[model samples]
Every structure is written in C-alpha cells, then in structure tokens.
Target: MEQLHNKNTHGVVRFITCGSVDDGKSTLIGRLLYDTKAVLTDQIQALTKTKHARVTASDAAIDLALLTDGLEAEREQGITIDVAYRYFSTVKRKFIVADAPGHEQYTRNMVTGASQADVAILLVDATRLDTSKSNISLLAQTKRHAAIVKMLGLKHIAVAVNKIDLLNFDEEVFKKIKEEILNLANTLKLPTPQVFPVSALLGDNIVNPSKNFNWYQGPTLLAWLEGLDISSEKSGVNLRFPVQYVARQDGSAAEDFRGYLGRVESGEIHQGQQVTILPAGSVATVAEIYISNGLNSFGQNTSVEMAKAGDVIALTFSEDVDVSRGDMIIAQDNSSDLLTKQLIADICWLDHDALSTSRKYILRHTTNTVFTKVKNIIQILDIETLSQAVEADSLGVNMIGRVELALQKPIAADLFDESLATGSFVLIDEATNHTVAAGMIREAL
Candidate 1:
C-alpha cells in the first residue's frame, strides 16, 4: 500500500471534482485513488466485501464509488451530499482532492471546497448530454458550477468527459461535448478548459491512457494534473496578516514582551521590517520575528527569526501599539488602500431563509467580526444566461448576487481581485448563528 504522506518532488496540487448530479465526481475520485495504489489492503477488502446493493453477485468488480460516499444518507440516495476530501501522492507530485456535491441545493458545499483549490476537474457525463442535436446544451447545474468557478477566480480548468464507454467511445460525441464546454468557458470568461474523454467506472484515461479511444491522443488526466504549473501565480502576492491573538508575558520576567500572533496569509515577513497597523493607521517597526516550531520540553512553542507565506509566527513591535485580535498588520509599502466601513460585494446566499435587508447579520472577515446589514441588492445573476437582473429584491438559497453592505465599524479589507485572504467574508445569522452567505469584496465604498 502507498502511504498518503509519501514525499513528492513538487508542491501539492489541490483540486476539486464538480459538475451536475450523476456526473461520477465521487467515482472519478475513487478511481484516481485506487489506480494510484493509495488504498490500503484492508480498505480494499472492506469495499469488495460490502459492494453496492445494485451490483449482482456474479459481478466481480468492486463498487469504486463506495470509497468516497461515506455518508449513509448519500449511499442510500446514490448521490453526494457533502464535500469529501482525500489525499494521495505520486512520485512526481502530491495531490489533495475534494469531491464536491453536484446537487443544486448543495452548491454551498461545493463553494467551500473550491475556495481552497487551485484547479477544478469538472466531470461531464456523456450519456446525460444530448449530442444528436446541432446545439448541444449542457445541464443547468453544470453551467452554474462553471460560473461559480469563474467568479471565484480559479485559473486552471479541465473538463473530463466521463462515462464515454457507454457511448461506445464515439469520437463525434466527445468532440461535441468538448466544443460546448469551450463555448461555455468563453461565455463565462474562464480560462480555456482542457477537455479529455474518460471512463471513470472502467478506469480508462484516468491514471493511464485508454486503448479504447484510438482517435484521441492526449495525456491522461493524472498526467496533466501532475505537470500543471501553479507555483508562479502564487508567488509575489502582498502581505495580509490578520492578527488572531495577542501574546504577552504572564509574569514580569520579560516585562514588556508583547507580540501579535497570526499566520502570514501572503508575502513574507522579516525582522526589523516596517509595518502598518490597519484601521488605526499606526506605523510600527518589527523588533523581532519568531516562527513557531512545534513544542519544546515545557510544551511551549519554539521560535525562529523569519517567516514567509503560510507560516504562523509571533511578531513584536518596537513601539507599544494598540493591536487587538481583529487588527491587521500589513506592509507599509503596500499599494492598495484597504480601510473602509461600506462595501460593494458579490455574494452567494447559502441559507434556507431569504436574505432580509432589515435583519442584522454578523460579518466575519479574516479575524474580524462586525455587525452589518444589507443596504441594497445591486443585481441577481441568472446562471443559465449569465446575465444580471436588477428587478430582484431578495436573494434565495443557492442564488448568487451583488449587494451593498453597511458595516457598524471600519475594517481592513482588500478587493477580492487584489487579495483573497483579506477580501472574502461570511454572513452569519445573529439569532441562530448559522452562516447565511459568503461574500467577496468587489469595491470599498
């Protein structure tokens, strides 16, 4: 059995499988895991012993979809209900795969998965699409998922034409689906999607090339994913550190030992660097930086001198500044201005209850939480046509729209296009504490 934590030469590629219902997102993930030799012997035995009820006793093939659909409700309904995450590694690269639900009602779950992914593998079931017509239309849920992927700014996209074995490996069908997917990508202004013909159930064109599709000559799905270059794009981003905790010396040993503890969301931080504390407009010099290194004999975190992006560190300032848990520490030379109390944003409504402008909601951005309300709904998006309509007043479940927000206090936030860490936020219902919506800051008003 191949261990999930095996070292790879390249950085981990985080991706999500998403599309319309019955697109074989879970099965595709299972196939990738199985073919990569990531499944343990005991796990494979368990899967073989408890095959799907639909499979006959004579059938020797294991139900691969059972590996990911762990929820009993999901197994009974034969559909994915929540986001399922799995890890596997090859000699060249490591992978973190997310199996996102395809149902329209569970769109929020998909959004949660896509938020952290660098690539998206959208599965299109060939049997579900009508290739006989001149103008083959994709499913409504497929279009919706693509639009959401574009909105979230995913750069790499791939369309896997799944279940091609059912269509007798027809070249014309694959070409038609590929053309329609290209058109959809153009309409949504997404990056040109790389299309491939695959049969997730039969283990064709997944980890290895399939001999059934003689006309097609493209790299296997795993090959393309392993060779993707996403590191350059992640580099050179500006620093956006949201203070999560304020650490101070308990006794008088150090006397004035005060440090701001948080993860460096982007860019890098060094000792003696000048930083600006947001919302308060206080300028301070970094006296010392301490990167967290596990725990010592006393169970206290050991420290180092410098830290970079993705590192959690404690930074002490030269001056005694009024820094709190919600305050943000940014580079003094940062180009964008990120302090504002009013904002215009694009939001996805996730709650069952409709958004009410009169009701007060809690807005949590980075580490800051403030009371907020919907001042006005700018427009509602029509997923099918990709048009914005201004006639709508309230947003319903799984609906994406633009809205203006009025915050009770000013916050440090960059536009979503500028910095994902500082721009994204969630709206929580004050009464029930349920997350009602996810918002991306478009502009500060």
Candidate 2:
C-alpha cells in the first residue's frame, strides 16, 4: 500500500453550479464561501460596510447575491450571464467552482464548465416550483438543466433547493421539491442525488444546520461537498495517460534516466507494465517512475511499480522510443479497436456561425489534432425534453447535435459514455485556432 498522506492536505474538487438564473446559484456560492470564511476579510468588509452594495435601506441587507453576480447585466437582471468561476479553500478541501449561467441561451457556457466537473450543484428555487428560465416556474429550468447535465455525463449531483424562506419554512414544500427533483434525476438515469433545502439569503443549509426548517434533517451543502468523493478512481475508468513531455539524461543521478512525463488522465499506471505509444505505435515496459525531476512536471524517478489512477508520474521505458507530446500512453491490455479516419460524434455547437457539411475544423482528441469536416447533422438533441430531432439541417450556437465527422487522420478516443477523459474532443477553427465546438465520440460514422 502507498503511504497515507497527512490529514491537512487540501484535496481538490471541481464542480459546476446548475439551475435557472433565479435559483440563487450565485448567491448560494457566495453564501458557501462567506460562511466558511473562505472569502477574504477585505471582501467581507466590503460586504458589510460598502454603501454600493445597497441603493437604499430597503436593499441595505448586504445582498450576498450581489457579491458573485459579477456581470452588470447579471446585477440588473438578478441572474448569472456568463460562467463565473470562483476559487476558495476549506480545511478539508480546495474548490474550483464554476457558477454557470442558468439561461437557455447560455447552454454552451454551461457545457464548457461541465467538461471538468466532478460534482454538479443543481439549485432549485423553492418558492416558484416550475422550471422556467426567468420567471416563477423555476422547476422547468431545473428539469431542463438536469437532463442536459446527465447527457453531458455528470452523475454525482447535489440538489440545493434554495430560497426556502419565501416558502414559509414549510417542510412539506421542501419534501415536495426534493421528491420532484429526485424523480427527474431518476428519469435521466442519474445517480442518487443529494438534496439540501437551503436559504442562501439567511445562510441556512449552507454552512450549518438551519433553525428555520426544524423538521427537516440532512447534511448541509458544505458538509456534503466536504464528504464528496475526490478519489480519482470514482470515474470507473482504466489507466491512460497522454504523454505531455519526454525527459532525457541530465547531470548527476539523472544522467542515465529517460522518462515519459504526463499526468494520468484516468485509471491506474504502474511500473513494469507493458505500455504502448500511440501514433508511432511503439511498446515498452515502464522501467522506472519519476517525480520531482529537474523539469517542473508532475512525476519523477521512483520504484512505484503500481500507482493508482490520477497519479502524475514520469515513466522510464526500457528502450529509446519515439514518444512525444500528442501521443497517448495506454496499458497493453487496455488497447482496443481505435478509429482511423472516420468517426460519428455528438457535437455541442459553440460557434456563432451555423455548422454544415462543408465546414472543416480541427478535431482535437486526447493529444492528437486532426483536420476534419462534418459529414452531416444527423440530429439535434433537445436537452429540455430529452428527444432527438432527426431532420435538422443546421446546428446553431448552443445547440447539441449528433453529426458525422470525417477526420484527415486517425485519432485515439473511446465512446463518450465509455470513457469521458479520452472520449470527448473539441473542434477548432483552423483559420483562427479558436475552439468552435465540443464533441463526444459516439462511434465511426
């Protein structure tokens, strides 16, 4: 067994915030940061003493919601516009939070944030049960987001039914919302999601237990996040690494060393296992593993014959091999039938211009980038209703579509539902080198 580290180490957790603009995603994040004392003292002072926080005494309550609703339009509309990212740390964990927009128009931004997320916090407005984008029917928005998120491959979620004070602290209302949310989640085949009845305005069910809803009993949002599994193994994936850099002999004890440096993208990587290099197709055993090398990469030389998933280590192969950045390292047994030139993909269209068969973009999968043209818009995914439209001619901005892509060269990737780390890719505008869309591998098409 590997040596256990100290308890005080900060385990990292990245997550996205969901729900409509009114579900208090921004306010909930602010409340979580505030109650945990994660926000700086200067910011906290501004919260209490600043006259700018309020236009009048009626607004003098120091709207914690104002603290994170960063966009001017967001402040005016009282909703999140763009994806607002915030970072903070508690005693047990360090967090990178993406408070994504709740509007249907901003679904692309939400997808960008969802790409790296391990947990999703779905905020539900308790007062208005429906899920509309901007009004009292917020549950409509909640259900829509739930479906999109599950389609986007997020399973672990925390449904924070916030703004409960306006519901008279009634346990029945809370129970009703929780049950509805769970039912929707179950419909999407999402895992058993944790639901927390919270009041971001009053800091209830955020940091500590709430006195407002005395009959309700559950862990607070913070406690749930704290207990969330940050283990790299949770994704249920096999070991794979995309080689980032290759290190060779230097001075001192490193003179005879050769290492393939990269962070493990999924599963476990162990020394002495036969590993294969992609593109060039070379195979060798990991002679040694390294960390703390002269270079500022993740791993160096070591005797770790077996390292679990998510470890970043430098692996020394037995012989000089043609491995470089943009090449993937795979366990010999894990290698399967890799696609060469044709693939069927589900693309989340992020480009302002509509996509058609004639458009050519760079398809980047794992460490390789290849030129490609979309063969067809097979179907557009209706995330809100969970249906597919078979006859769509074009995919507009923020639309999720299943399209046939023909690549200029072969790339290594798996089916999206099979392995998210290696299965997802992005299409870049060859001219501008800007990412135009995100795609998931469905199969060769």
Candidate with top lDDT is 1
* 2-42 per-residue lDDT for model 2 (tens digits): 11112233467778898876777887888777777777778
Q: Give the lDDT of residue 116 in candidate 1.
A: 85
Predicted candidate 1 versus true structure: per-residue lDDT over 314-349, tens digit per residue: 888888889999998888997356789999999999
Worst 10 residues of 2 by lDDT: 1-10
TM-score of each: 0.93, 0.82
Give lDDT: candidate 2, residue 132.
31
The TM-score measured for candidate 2 stands at 0.82
lDDT of each: 0.85, 0.74
Model 1 regions more than 4 Å off = 1-9, 51-60, 232-237, 253-256, 295-302
